[model samples]
Target chain A: MSLSKQHELHTRRYGRNVGVGLLLVGVIAIVFGLTVVKVTRGDYETPATTTVQE
Target chain B: MTDTSFNSQTGTYQTEATFGDYFALLKPRVMTLVVFTAFVGLLAAPTPVHPFIGFCAILFIAIGGGASGALNMWWDADIDAVMKRTQRRPIPAGKVTGDEAFAIGMALSAFSVVFLGLATNWFAAGLLAFTIFFYVVVYTMWLKRWTPQNIVIGGAAGAFPPMIGWAVATGGVSVESVLMFCLTFMWTPPHFWALALFMRKDYDNADVPMLTVTHGRRATRVHILVYTILLAILAVAAGFTSIGGPIYLSVAVVLNVLFLRGAWQIWRRDEDMSEADNFLTERKFFKLSLLYLFAHFGAILVEAGLDKLGWGLWA
Candidate 1:
């Protein structure tokens, strides 16, 4: 069989494969969105009110 | 890869388990209840969460709940196959194997817990972990088949989502969260016993020791009435708590009256009478139970909304 030929696994289990593919994409979107929100809210920033005097 | 198109032993197309079948293993209907209660819990809290955070919190909580459901299905496949209601489940129907179910359950369990902890507070994550354990290990494994009081104690597992939701906001338990937990806990028995009443002979054939199976049908009816009365008290009293307001109290009072009336009607009938009427009252009560929980939570959500608008009684 040629390398470009579609495997039976892909064709037979199309729904399962597509579902998993979409789920992976959804996970990426959620993680990216959460990161953006956290960054914008300064959830990880050092406290501005704190000071150290030598 | 290797002729993964058939279930040789079952002689069915099990290997081709679709996305829907895998989803079915999660018991989506039960997940709806979990997600709704968790959302109510999160929104009802005094602290406001970021919208995205709140959404993620509820989603993770629901996935964790579904993971527990999958684990329960894996563990209870034998009895599930025997029961008419559960016979079409993925495991029982031969669409998925027990091992696959367990794997999915465990993977999702870990993913949901870790992400929930990262997204919210560890306290809420811990509660989710415990809820999963209680449902799978304690309730399903130990309590369900061993005793007829299974659903009574196992009700705690279903009742924890709201508390977990509250923790997502407050990072700890509180009187209001406990009240929400109590509402669901007190409501589970009558709801399930009604199911057992109408779905007669299901538990008997499964040998699962449900109240209807272990106790006589008359005893089941009496138990339903007693539990209904107790549940009405709890549901009504919840309206006076911090989570409650005028709207909640009104909804609670009306629903409890109708619920108690349904239970009373159920209590007055014998098996012969129930059979003659096709278990109409029991079935009706069962349907009403769904509306009962949703309305109570809906009322609470409304009161929370009203509080935001400064129109709430306690505002």
Candidate 2:
């Protein structure tokens, strides 16, 4: 069946769905923010020992 | 995807688990203590952390605390169902089941620990992991049912958040973190025992070995008085620490005096007087205890902030 209306299940679980959706979004934002900060601060930078100096 | 419960009397499948029901699994009130103390711990440290990193650190710490709460609820579902205070919890009220609580708890526990390690440092992450384990396995599963000294020992679980917060910034433990931990650790027994003082029957009915239940309420009263005196001394002494200054000392002196007075009032009253007064003193003391803790931590946070501006301390 083609989707035409909100399913009873969907309506019943709407609040929980919204909450889960928002939480997932928050997780993504945190991960992305942490990454940008880490990279900018050179937290992931390698030590000079990683380079082979002849 | 599907969480449905069938009611035989109603002849319906009720979608009883709301977003709030799931949220309740996380004992949000306890998480507030975790968040506040951890935030204070992080800020109170000598080292400065990046704002975003600090925020993530607190968030992960709170999630770890909430995860442990869920686990505690799962383990205590039986006792919680019987206890009036805890009867409305998600599991006991039948809003969520034990298995679901356990799964969410485990998932969040692992997620929080891994994220904390990445976001801050592995030392804090490991402390968070130990806190979750201590609250769940040591406190909930083992100590809670087995000992009348449950709150004394299990209180350590609640006290770990600040230390974890300090760890988030300093990447190691120190005297200040230990002091903060001890403040909460010492405070827990009297705070909870006063609760047990007034709400005596709940523990007796639930068969949890509260000091009021195992010892007589008379003994519990003496215990409260003793612990409070010790707490007051510790509270005032902590004011001289590096975390403290003029404002902190003032807050400490005033609140500790008040807290000692409340504890003394509790000790002096007999049960007959207590029942006649409807536990007014115990209830008032309980209320003050909340303010007592928050104000102490708030003073610490203020000191930390002022220190940043080079105007923090009395000395």
Candidate 3:
């Protein structure tokens, strides 16, 4: 293969790896953002006890 | 190694870096400890973290730990080149450049910290950032070459992960988290010292001021005993904390006894003993030290699990 072609192929491969890594990061970030929202809004808080009267 | 190719067009040397090389820069083994301890800390916290949040926290903390390892490798490349144990590391072995390692470390450090802050809380992120700084700056750059007490003081960096995990769950620190941190912190000196005892020549050749190199093997042995005694006290005492219970206490007691016996064996050795024999005792102690921390943390994890089941001792 020509030097330019090899260089181009390398560049494309590198870009692909970075793209995948960034995609994973994006997904994790979204999950984290949702969790943060849920936490800050007290979604995980314990429910108040309701006593039953006979 | 750097695979250089003749660029018939530009005629410049270009380094061919690989995925494994980059991964090696992260020091995955150390990252494992950081991740596991942090996971335990998060689970053992009073408030439960959302599953997704917990996973994100551990992932980011591991990244932070890896970043620190890369930065450490970057700075310690010189000593690493001299030492037998680290001579084949990416940088020293000519696989990765110092600049490349530094850039990766800095980028990952910033990425992990920022994303962790967004994922969990700024408190945990801050602790992660401090951990990176302490490992890279305090331990690698400043202390490792300058003082025999490097591991003693610098162990705090390794000790912070569990606390950060706890912070991820509660957005604050507590006595439980502090005790967990103490467990790792106190365990650090003797662990490294035992390894140093066996690998004394590595520090000597590198001219790093490890206690073994600075104070002689006898003094190092004395230090090990002293630290192990102190560690035994701390490790067992940690069992009584809120994070600890019958399971943790039982594990801690047995592990500390074995650990103390190992330290005593090392302490009792005299100069007349063969290097091979000394190496055996030190190597055994070193191996046990690894299990000592893991079992302690594992026991804490079991206690946390039992707590969730309403079967914990305190429950």
Candidate 3 docks with a DockQ of 0.13
* Candidate 1: fraction of native contacts reproduced: 0.64
lDDT of 3 by residue, B102-216 (tens): 9999999999999899878899899999999999999998998899999999999999999999999999989889999998999999999988887868999999999988889
Give the Å error, residue B227, model 2: 0.4
- In candidate 2, the residue pairs with backbone N, CA or C atoms under 3 Å apart (3 or more residues apart, or in different chains) clash, namely none
* lDDT per residue as tens, model 2, B171-249: 9999999999999999999999999988879999999989898999999999999999999898889889888889999
C-alpha lDDT of all candidate models, in order: 0.92, 0.92, 0.87
**Runs in model 1 with CA error above 4 Å?**
A1-4, A47-54, B1-15
List model 3 lDDT by residue over A9-50, tens digit each: 556358548856886798767776776777787878999999
Tens digits of per-residue lDDT for model 1, B1-315: 564556654455665689998999889999999999999999999899999999999999999999999999999998988899998999878889889999999999998999899888899999999999999999999999999999999999999999999999999999999999999999999999999998898899999999888888899999999999999999888888878888899999999999999999999999999999899999999999999999999998999888877788864
Rank by lDDT (best first): 2, 1, 3
State which docking tier applies to candidate 2.
high
lDDT (Cα, 0-100) at B231 in candidate 2: 90
How does residue A53 of candidate 1 score in lDDT?
85
